[model samples]
Target: MTSKFYEDTKVIVKDKLFEHGWGILKDLYLGETPLASIAQKSFETATGTKLATVYLLDLFKENIVAIHGEYQSQATNVLSTCNVFIKENSTANEVSNCVDDFLKNANHYIDESFSRRLFLKYGY
Candidate 1:
């Protein structure tokens, strides 16, 4: 991904994940992400070949996975992929803290640019 889009994705992911109980998305580069293929196929089925071609070829490069894997280690995946159960009685602040903790832990695995973007966006 380009630096600009990466920054934008970071902002959107942080904000939406903070507000919603479930807003995690699978990037096109990750092989282990279960949603990646499904999301790709879904887009293809809905929009024909146009979107998937751009997504798979132009937008995200498959060759980046080897380098991406080095940064996105197993511990990072575990910390970021936690399944939090938000109770009906839970306050918004409580939920925010949980998400913030997840994001803070996730900082270790991402690139410095993306990490800086998240820190600026979330102010922590």
Candidate 2:
């Protein structure tokens, strides 16, 4: 079953993100958002990691994704970190940056993963 955040909230965010013309971004998300993780070629997952979120904007009708957080295992750098609460009243710019950063991170991970495979198969 999909999370309620996914069913009800993606549209609002997709619209907002699109309207703002954000190519990709990382923004404040409530503690509960329907998001997925964009795994690295050799990525890992665990509890408390805010991965990436897949979005389909209304206007574009194409899916995009945004990611944040990091991977840490066996007590690595990210294992003990906490989600920085986007300030209760953050400025518009701060929020925008977060969203943008997230999108860029997600896209980079995704693009790199697919491109390598495509190149291997077809020599791009």
Candidate 3:
């Protein structure tokens, strides 16, 4: 059985990321323990914002990952939104940089992870 999130959401490709455009990016789990650890660290070291959403995409083929979140602090009444898109082959450092860049440029915020799930399960 494939994970619920994978079954429902389409894989995020480079074209889709381009379609979303760029903005400020503000951006886990167990037994998941090691995978979750890498994922959590990837986001934690990359951006200065709270992680609000996560998505694992391009499964089997590329294992692409994307995230959406907001900056940790804001003085205004409105909060800035951030989006990050990582290629399937990105290294740990690259993942961090990709996220950091996204948050720095994000301007608006919207809900994109309605179908996203925190757990990942795969079985034969």
Candidate 4:
């Protein structure tokens, strides 16, 4: 069964990351830019804030790890695929393709009986 929370989080993260444009998307997947930076940028862009609080940053970091763990649990091949994209000198198109495949194969379900988490932790 698909999880509404997981699906919602996925859409939210993707939309936020792509909000300004697709310019940073490749940088993120390539490891040239960190997800934290993107998260902060997204927050600032959405809220017009000059700075994000440490609490928000910590929450984002924690939820990001939790979300990754959930994704890994749902798709066993996710880490290996991500490793390939990150560790290898893959072209932009190759990385995009790999990410697309990974997303396509992921099972968007959460163990709802346990902690119900979202990537950003709070809505923008």
Candidate 5:
């Protein structure tokens, strides 16, 4: 998939899994979780194509499992930045812009990581 499409699919799958409380399960452990099924369905729905189960699982691992910690770190950084802006009495617009920029960067990071992992694993 193209980077843009993969990134969009990641957002959809992430939202769907989170809606089903996948984050809590992820924090606990891994292996045959229902989130995999949810992720597969979400991907098919978003992309109009059904990938093999193994491929789907790999995609899930790359998109969610592998990057969970980094995602959390980015989230923390954005929150800290917002807090700093608040403490400095920065304008609301400044805080909003910071958050927007962080989100854009975070999405780029996810896309880049996903592409890198796929290339390393499959040599695409």
Candidate 6:
């Protein structure tokens, strides 16, 4: 990802995670999140991608499992995979591989803290 996009993604992620910040993503990186985002732990979009699954819920911070995982895109496969991942998923490392892939995609400016935790598993 380019530095501009990386910076944008960082701002978006932080705003979504912070209290009284200015972000409004419904769920964590929901959709494809750019295969690259999951692959390397970041995203690159001059604007936005249809596959990107980021949205805001509210202004106040909320607790949610970081849903950024790799799985088949189809609904059936996705549902089944989600069941398996949620049931089998353990600590933050469960998604580190995915995150590593996300960074490898080459987002030029990832916030130093973006990949610190697995998804949104950190305490609020």
- Highest-scoring model, TM-score: 2
Question: Model 6, 1-124: lDDT tens per residue?
Answer: 1233233343434443233222233333436342223211123222221132222122112222233432222232221222111112233343334333332331222211233222233422
Candidate 5 per-residue lDDT, tens place, 7-111, comes to 343344455435533442231115533232222211121213222111112233233211221222222321222211111233445434533443455444433
TM-score of each prediction: 0.27, 0.34, 0.30, 0.26, 0.28, 0.20
lDDT of 3 by residue, 1-124 (tens): 2343432232222223334443212222333321211121111212222343233332434454555433232332112334455655565566556645653453323212211111111110
Q: What lDDT is obtained when candidate 4 is compared to the true structure? A: 0.29
lDDT of 1 by residue, 1-124 (tens): 3333333333433454435333334554545332222111111111122111001111233211100111222224323333233333335465456445544543333323344344445654
Q: lDDT for every model? A: 0.32, 0.37, 0.34, 0.29, 0.32, 0.28
Which candidate do you rate higher for lDDT, 1 or 6? Answer: 1
Candidate 1: lDDT of 27? 56
Q: Extract clashing residue pairs from model 2.
A: 24-100, 25-99, 25-100, 26-98, 26-99, 26-100, 27-98, 27-99
Worst 10 residues of 3 by lDDT: 115-124
For model 6, state the Cα shift of residue 76 in Å: 26
Give the range where candidate 4 is weakest over 10 consecutive residues by summed lDDT: 49-58
Ranking of candidates on TM-score, top first: 2, 3, 5, 1, 4, 6
Off by over 4 Å in 4: 1-85, 108-124
Give the clashing residue pairs of candidate 4, or none.
none
User: 1-124 in candidate 4: lDDT tens per residue?
Assistant: 2233323443444453344332222213235323322222211222232221110011332232122211222323222322112212334454345445433333222212112123224333
Worst 10 residues of 5 by lDDT: 78-87
Kindly provide the TM-score of model 1 when superposed on the true structure, using C-alpha atoms. 0.27
Candidate 2 regions exceeding 4 Å error are: 1-13, 19-85, 114-124
Model 1 Cα displacement at 40 (Å)?
Answer: 15
RMSD of each: 16.7, 12.5, 15.7, 15.0, 15.6, 16.3
For model 2, how does the per-residue alpha-carbon lDDT over 1-124 read when each residue is reduced to its tens digit? Answer: 3333333334343444465443333433436432333222233222222233333221212222222344333334232222222332445465456556554554444334433335445654
